[model samples]
Target: MSLEDLVRGAAAEARRLAAAFPAAGRKDDLPWAVIAAFDADVRGHVERDRRIEDERDRVLIASVTLAETPAEAEAEEWDRARRHLVRAVDYLEETVLRFGIVNRLAAKRGHGAAGDPVSALRRG
Candidate 1:
């Protein structure tokens, strides 16, 4: 799927999950481990999706630079590079979805009712 489509989907899902975290009482002074999970979950989603965009753009640039020498480039080398870049992009998108879920879970649980303690998550 396109990067914009992927990001929009992630954002929508994150919002849905965040809305539910509180009703489930998922916040009950969750264990440090759980909190860590929550943090990772949220950050992971954001960072992963971001990384996907970054890697994709990077690959686009590199690929463009290499386009002039298609005959000179080894097939195997090109294939390998393409595979790695695709994998990186996939990983980024997956993580973004995962962390988005975690953030939603956290928000639903009243983890930030008094104030958003995890404001960092809101930042880019």
Candidate 2:
């Protein structure tokens, strides 16, 4: 199919999905509060994860700087860098999954191995 046709199809699908949103409820219903609570819970989990990752980076940095030998420090630095790349790629794939686009061009994108970071990392 032509690129224009694909774009139009995706736009139509998005509109169809948007139309499926639930209608507003009666005044007696507490759905708004429930939705807010769900939002807060998700935000809290995300924030906690960030804190944990930050701590790990901080500890790794301190250890690498304190290593007695240059070779040891270099090894520690490489290990920490590898860990960071793994986490970043994992988050990238998760974000792509949440993205609404069908991503038909993923494998065609200019990432060399595969456009998907997680898959490319695994292949290497």
lDDT (10s digit) by residue, model 2, range 5-96 = 33234333322322221132232221232223223322222222444344334433432332212343565554554344334323422432
Candidate 1 residue 98 Cα shift, in angstroms, is 0.6
**Predictions in order: lDDT:** 0.38, 0.31
RMSD of each: 17.3, 19.8
Which window of ten consecutive residues has the lowest lDDT sum in model 1?
Answer: 29-38
Runs in model 1 lying further than 4 Å from the true structure: 1-5, 8-71, 101-124
Q: Clashes in each model (backbone N, CA, C under 3 Å)? A: 8, 0
TM-score of 1: 0.31
